[model samples]
Structures are given as C-alpha cells and as structure tokens.
Target: MDTTPIAAGTGHAEAAAGGGVRVGALVPLSRPGWVEAGRQLLAGLELGVGDVNRGGGISGRPLELVVRDTAADPAKAAAAVEELAGTGVAAVVGEYHSVVARAAAAQADALGVPFLCSSAVLDALTDEPTEWVARIAPAQSRGWRIFADFLLGAGHRRIAVAAEPSVYWAAGARILREHLAPRGGTLVELDARALGPAALCDELVAQRATALLLLVGTPEPAVPIVTSVRHDPRLADVLIGAPAGQPEFAEWASLLGGDGAAIPFLRYLPEHLSPLGARVEAALRERLDEAASFVAFEGYDTIAVLAEALRAHHGTRTKAADFWPHVTAEGTRGTISFSRQPALTAWQWTWPPIQVADRDPANPTRFRVLHTG
Candidate 1:
C-alpha cells in the first residue's frame, strides 16, 4: 500500500515491490437520477480495485481511486475531468452517459490520460481521433447492427424505431435503420419525441407498426409506451425489443402479463446478470456480488482492462499517447483492443447473450438470445 511510483511500464514484480498508484474515477453523482448508476459503477470499480490490491496490487503499488461526481451534465463532466487533470491519476474511468463521456473525452485528451468510458453508448466516443479514451462497452452503432441482424433473421421483416432526439437514442435508431436496409427489413417508424413517458407513448402508438425497437435509456421512460403497445389490439402482434440502454424489461412484461412476447436483444446482459452470459460471469459475480447491468459491467470491465494495461507496463509510466497501442486485454464482454482511426483502440466488443423475454403463462418473461434469421 506504499505510494512509491513504479517505473512506467515496469513488470508486476518490480511495481508490486514498490506498492500502488492512484487512479481517478469520475461518475455522475450530483443528481438523484444518476446517483444509483454512479454508485453501481463505484461498487464495480471498488470490487475490481480490491481484487487487484488483494492480489498484491498493480505493479507492486496498490490501486487507489479518487472519485468525482459530474451530475450527468456535459459541462460538469468536463469540469470534473479538468479537476482530475493534474491529480496524477494513472488513468480515468467513468461517465455513464454518452453525453458526459463526450465531455470527459475532450478533457482527457488534452491532459493525455487514458480515459475509460464505462456506459456511454454513442459511437462518437470512438468515431473521432482520440488519444486516451477507450470504451469497454459495445458502441451504440454495434448494438444497432446486432439487434437488426437478430430481428431480420428472426423473421421480423418490419421494425418500428422510436426514441427522443437525444444523441444516444437517435444514434441507435440511425445505425439500426442503416443495418436493416440490406437485410430486407425496413424501419417503419422513426418517431422523434421531445416529451415524457405519456407523450412518448402517444407518439409510439401512432406509428402503426408491429415490431418495436425502443431506443430509450430506461424502462420508466418507456412504461407508458409499453403499456400502449401491449394494450392496443392494433399492435398486438408486435415483438418488443430494446437496446441495453434501458432497465430490465420485467417491469413492462409484468404489467402486460401474457400479452408480451420475447425481447431478443437487451444489449449488455453480462455474466453477472445472466446465468447464460459471458465467460467471466462467475468470477465477476464473485467480485461484484451481482451481475452487472450492461453499463455497469462495461464500467467494471473498463477498470479491469486498464488495470492490465498498467500491469503490463509495470507501472504508470506510459501516458495515453504511448499507451494507446499497448491497450490489449480481454474481459467478460470481449477483447478490449483499440482503433487509431479515431485515435482510440481497435476494441469493439458486444454482449452476445441476446436477452429475450415473454409473458406466457407457460414461460415467464426473461432475456434469452434468439435466432432472428
């Protein structure tokens, strides 16, 4: 637990001999809406750091985390990163929303520190040239592709896409439509709303389409929409699915009862949550005491990958500029590689356990992968 700095890129033997280094964790903690998500992230990171330290710390130095709250606002997120700039953190991990991650990316780049985005879904994080920012979760673009492929294959020829105009939702819908075009399916609705649940529900119901691709972040926002979708006999045949952006589908299914059908894809159903998920399910559960929400595990895995990067180099010597190419690690989701096109790593990972659920009396609703094709 000594604060001695290990030589940058030193081996664990030497670094461990020296003790541990300090890391920074930036989460959105300033608001009630973002507090639990931030807490979940902190919980995962704590579990990860504890494991590393218990195993003799990273590069002989234990990993220390300095946490800050961004309040889920982009400007606040940037300010938080600015505060951590000169704090001498080996790396930065956090910012759950894509909006906040985008802000941290700008600051982390200027400071030349490795930034790990735990839950942000927008591909914008990896789309442009970024030296230090690497995302541990599947980009929203990939989520669109995976879900589109699953639906097209599952014989769903029609899809109704819906979301607010926010970057996260819009980006997801855009990518899904693009991926769906070649598959012989079509996005029948792209209802862009600027309102809350009830208003959004009215818009969604007006789509007049059957299969639904909900792009909202949480189930609460979609509860009214789901209620309308299931209760209205006009849309009775619709198959419901959502990206990992939202909370568990159980809320809607429980309300709709036997009216609901399976949800083929729910983004990141990490091993922690799904008994049939990624390879690291057991180990992750043992460490974090629960299966990670798609975003939480992404955050946990982000920390895990960065820890390896630090261990690989022996200590915190490599800055983001030099560390970009060296960031190669695997997690419960997939390989954490990077692509330099946007100046980020080539890592693009996904949660393959397509979470499918239904409300049949014979088969209670829950997530499971489906063969869309």
Candidate 2:
C-alpha cells in the first residue's frame, strides 16, 4: 500500500454556500457484474443528488456527479482518486473490493478528500492510521461473527469454512475461527483456494467440511465455487453460507434454474438491515429494470452517507473529520459508521438467519429464523 500523500487542489472552485456540488465515483465498468453494481450505485447517488437538486439544489446550486472507471485495480483505483482530487469533487464514493478500496481510501485521506467506501469489507481497509475511509458496510470480522452465531444457534457445531485467498476472505475466515472455537464448536477444516473452476471443485470435494463459507466478493469467484459444489456429492450435506452483500448467491440461485435447484445456505447480515431496503429495490427497478442486490445496497448506502456528510459539514471541503460525525450518528443505512482501528464491535455485525430449502438465492423458498440478533 502506497502511503504517499495526494494533493487535492487543482484550483477547482470550492462548493460554495449556494453553488454547484460535485461528487465523483470511481467504479469498474468493464466487469459485467460490478458494472451492474456500479450502475445501481450511481443510480442511488443520482437519485439522492437529484432529489437534493430538485429540492432547490443544495442552497440553490445543483448537485452533479463525475464518474470515472477504476477498472477495479489498485493502480487504477489510485488514479481514479487522484483524478477526482484535481476535479474539485466534494467527496468520492466507490470501490467494491476491500484491498482496492483500502488503497483508494489511503489516497483520499492523504489528499484530505472525504471518501465513502460502498463495498469494501476488510476491517483493515478502514481500520488503520487514517479517518477518511469510512464504509457503509460492516467489517469482514463483524460479518464473520454473525455467521458464527448463526451456525452455533442452529446446533451445527461441526463446520468447515472455505474462502478465497484475498485479504478480505482471509480476515473473515480468521474471525469465524475465533468466534466459532469458543462456542464449544470446531472448525474441522479451513481452506483458502485459488478462484478457478477446477481448483474450486477440488477444494469443495477434498475438504472434510459441512458448511462452505464463500468469502470472495465477485460473482466470477463465487459462481464457480457454487457450481462446483452443486455437482459434488460429498458436499450435498454441506450448507453453503455467504456473508451478506454478495449478489453472487442470488445470481447462482437464479442460474441453477431457480428455487430447489441449489444447495441449502445461510447469510450473515450487517447491522441496520432495515425494510428501507425496499426504497433501494425500487430505485434499482427504475434505473436498471431489475432488483438491486446486496452489493447494490452497499453502494446505495455509501452515497446516502456521503450526501449526509456533505450537508452536515456545510460543504467544508469534504474533509473526513467533517463527515465522520454524521455517518456515525445519523445516516440512512441506520447508523453507518467506522473508526480508524482494526477492532470489530458487536454493533457492526449480526448473524441474521435465512434457511433456504429451495434453490432461489434471491428469494429463498422456505426459511426458519434461528438467530436474527
């Protein structure tokens, strides 16, 4: 991670008390999956910004957005942040990957530019020496604990967890191990494999695990794992689990011929999972003619927090200090907040229960609530 400072001044005019406000997004448009995520994200932001603009445009100046594709790479992510710095964007919202967002957040903090991460899940992404990297989603560790509590409450003590080798997945695996070990339970096997077709299928069959935890965020990584597992007879009893905010599960359910076609599964939920998600769903329908995924909500919540911060700070150059307060105390995602520490608080993650007897990941056919706390 480059810790070099980025300069945010290209002499772009500051958002005046009654002047135009610009928020930029560094999204990955090349990937079909993330492109949809990004589109929903931009749509959410546009809705928020458009509402603000329509309601008299933030003290009489319209809100505007400048979007740039980061290609979802570290260097390109950094470039996107730097590019926004020169454009006088009051704040930037982007990133679905923790590692990439972590880099971009560091750049935003160095430049004193406020950044709201929409999809990054790694606790360390915002849990370090900077304040600019607040996220709308809960940390990976929090979600891990949630998943652990779910497994324990369901009387499923013997478990096997597998995730991608990415830092985010690794963090979730660690947290799950720590949380599960203390509950009179055991993680019989924990494996992190490469994200490939054969490699995933091999891991699915080779490991002596009951429940599979797919930690990779991208669908490309998750689809193969699920597809491989669906075919393997050994994994038939193993329940597939994913931390919430992954759209791949639902997409997989749909692709596998919908409900009753895939294996049973569970998902962990972040704090503040409210019915308000319907508003987001409706927005996605209008924007993309489809329902928004959990990832889409991450993006939607990100923009909500950024707009609230800008309003709270009265457009004071979009500094992190100015925005963190609003994000913590009052935000649309119901207490969206983060600190510059690597610790996971109980408020951050919760294991909500959803038992899918059918295969539809989007809307599980049959569910019995075990633990929603």
Candidate 3:
C-alpha cells in the first residue's frame, strides 16, 4: 500500500533521498467517519515536525513525515504499517481508533518497528506482550477512574452508564461499576446498541439517574444519545458525560448542535495549560486557524516524545527496544514513565493528567473547563 507524504512545505524529494529521518503517521484521513479527527492529528504531528526541523532536527538531520490514511480500518492500518516498515521510517505514530491501533501495533511488532500510539485508549493496545508498541494516552481504566471520581465529587450519587458492547466501552463500564458500587453509589447500566436514544432517555429518567455516563465509542452513536437526552424535558437536567470519548472532539459538538451544551468528557491535558502546552496551543491555533483539541495535544506530544527519543539515541538506535527507555521518560505533556508492576504493558503512560470539560452552548466550538480531577 502506498502512503502520501506531508512535507509541511519542506523538501519532500530531498528528504526522501536520504536527507532526513522519516517517521510514519497512520491516520484516517480519507474515511468519512474519521476525516476531521485525522486532519487535526495530522496538523499536530506536522507542527512537531516543523518544530524539530527548525531546531536542527535529530543530530542535524531533518524529520520527514510519511503520512498514511488508515481510513479507520484495521486491515488498512496493518497494511500501512507493513508498507511503512519497508520504507525504513525511524518510528511510527498517530492512530485515533483503538481497533486500528491494535492492528497497527501487531503489525509494528511483526515488522520490528516502533509505534507510539497517540490517542487510542483501549487497554489491549498495550496489554499484549509486544516490545514495539507504546502509548502516550492513558488507558481506559485510568480514564474511567477519573470520570467516576469527577462524578462522585460533583455529588452525582445515582449514575447511569450508557455503553455499547465494544471492547473499549465495555472495559470502561466495568471499571465504572467497580469504582462506584463500593462508594455507596448506584449505577444503572444501559446498552446503547440495544436501546434507541429515546428509550435510553426514558430508562435514565425512570431510574432517577442524575448523571448519564456515556461510553459510546464514537460520535455517530453519541450524537443521537446527547440529542435525545437534551430534548426530553424530564432528562434536561441530567448531567451527560463520557470517559475520554466522543465529547472531546469538536465534531461531536457540531453534530449535536445546540443540544451539545454542557456535555462533559475526560481529557488528558489539564484545563490550565502548562508553559509548553500554552506554546503548543498557540502554534496550533496559528497554523490550523482553530482551537486545538485534546487529540491534537496528544498528537503533538507523541511526536515530540519520539523526536526526543530519536535525539537521545543519536539517531543510531532506531529499534523499538533501543528507544523504549527514552520514550518512557519525561515529555512535554507529562512524564511518560511506564510501570510494569501495575501493568504488563512495556510503555504505558501512567498517571497522566486528566480533566473534565463541557461544551458551551454559546460556543459549541469551544469547551468550558469544568473540573480538573
């Protein structure tokens, strides 16, 4: 499979002719479902490349991005990995969907190429025993805990969890149940795929649920759920939330229109930006002509971490195992240090900062920071 090269106005031909270090980006740029997300992720990665190139790059060699459109498909993602492996990129990064990340991880392992997952949150993406895969995003378990804590702190005792049957959503739901049941809080579980949005709203109201924790994995299902709940007068006051899911993206708000107001979701970055975060945000705003989302932050940080690792190894250690230590060290977003005692994953970013933000009705494009947990 052939992949496109986004040179960021740099010398694509010169870079490909042994003038730069190549890094592969696997994002769903062509698929109708994930096009916007792919675009934002690509923008963040390009910004990272631009910054590195401006700083004389790794060991004075420029960083070139070889872009591949995963199209949100697992098979296509794996194929892209195989193609990138053959192309001799120093590392690979960028995937929004968990399933695609899993596929890309497996292919990266088979091909012995290092893969830094930017935004995929499924635990299994790193759970499998693979030396080639590392993730910059916190796993679903950590995200669920943050969401549950936020709900409990907000006095949301009676909560409803609306989740689809996907592995990612199911894991989040299980974590929520385990965390909330012991705190003297009640949880009402609803199958999003089994029930219509209106029926789900009715169920939430009947159960006297004060908050609806939506674990729907994507924006398509979330739109209907958010709209149905908002339109129902009985459920108007119900606090709707998700565990680092659809609500973090601007497209989710756009799809729900005015109904997207006050929907909360967990984010890895804090409400108040760090000095580095503020700089990155400014760069993103200037380049993309829009506010950066959490996904973009993850994208930028992932590439930044990879660039740091490449520089630390002096561009000689390109193998996954060779760069694992440097990649897990401190980074721009936060310390990406991994722990094996708590989990088996080789490089899982433990204890990443998480915050809950809600979309503003007045400005659906911008989210209002609610609480940083």
Write candidate 2's Cα lDDT for 28-125 as tens digits: 66654266556656566555555455555444555666777665677888888898888787888767666788778878877888777776667765
lDDT of each: 0.62, 0.58, 0.78
Question: Can you rank all candidates by lDDT, best first?
Answer: 3, 1, 2
Instruction: Give the 10-residue window scoring lowest on summed lDDT in candidate 3.
Output: 337-346
lDDT of 2 at 271: 33
Candidate 3 Cα lDDT to native: 0.78
User: Each candidate's TM vs. the true structure?
Assistant: 0.78, 0.77, 0.91
Best by lDDT: 3
TM-score of 3: 0.91
Off by over 4 Å in 3: 316-319, 327-332, 335-341, 361-366
Displacement of the residue 351 alpha carbon in candidate 1, Å: 9.3
TM-score of 1: 0.78
C-alpha lDDT (0 to 100) for residue 49 of candidate 1: 69
* Candidate 3 Cα RMSD (Å): 2.5
Off by over 4 Å in 1: 1-20, 29-36, 190-207, 247-261, 269-291, 340-366, 371-373
Cα deviation at 40, candidate 2, in Å, is: 2.7
